[model samples]
Target: MLTLTENASTIVKTLAAQAPGSDDTGLRISSTNEEHTAFSVGVADAPEPMDLVVESEGARVFLEPGAAVALDDKVLDATLDDRGSVSFAIGLAE
Candidate 1:
């Protein structure tokens, strides 16, 4: 299963809370194209029928089947850059 670092969880929770219909919104991850060579992440109202739900620190993330498989045993991390912009990094679990 995919796991979120503390910072990642906090960021996700904050984003979700600010979204409209926050109660039903979660972070959704999926392929950017049919080839699955890239990915896209955004807030969604709900999970798809076969999506995998991963929760941590009050945040929820819905991963498409293929994304879930690709992220298995991976860790989701967040970092702030010099410009104060936040970004995410995905890596194998230690």
Candidate 2:
């Protein structure tokens, strides 16, 4: 199932507040390129549904449809020991 960590929720809340006239917002993560590889983030009034968790700087992230197929049942994690890095392990589908 998709999960958002405390830090991730904070980031999302902060970004949502930054949008003009947007009182409610969620991370709009989507896949890009025909390679079906790569993702991007932006503030949106709505966040696509998914069942994955992405960890970055102690924050958890959720993916939208465009990114779900590639990320389905994936456990993503990120760290900042020296530089920023994101890694993941694929999980079996339910």
| lDDT for each candidate structure | 0.87, 0.51
Off by more than 4 A, model 2:
47-62, 75-94
What is the Å distance of residue 43 in model 1 from its true position?
Answer: 0.9
For every model shown, what is its TM-score relative to the native structure?
Answer: 0.87, 0.52
Clashing pairs in 2: none
The lDDT of model 2 is 0.51
Per-residue accuracy of model 1 over 1-94 as CA lDDT, tens digit each: 9999999998888888878884868889897766664778998988999999999989999999888888888898988779977788898899
53: Cα error in model 2, Å: 13
**Lowest-scoring 10 consecutive residues by lDDT in candidate 1?**
31-40
Best by TM-score: 1
Once model 2 is optimally superposed onto the true structure by TM-score, how far is the C-alpha of residue 17 displaced, in angstroms? Answer: 1.5
Candidate number with greatest lDDT: 1
What shift in Å separates residue 63 of candidate 2 from its native position after superposition?
Answer: 4.0
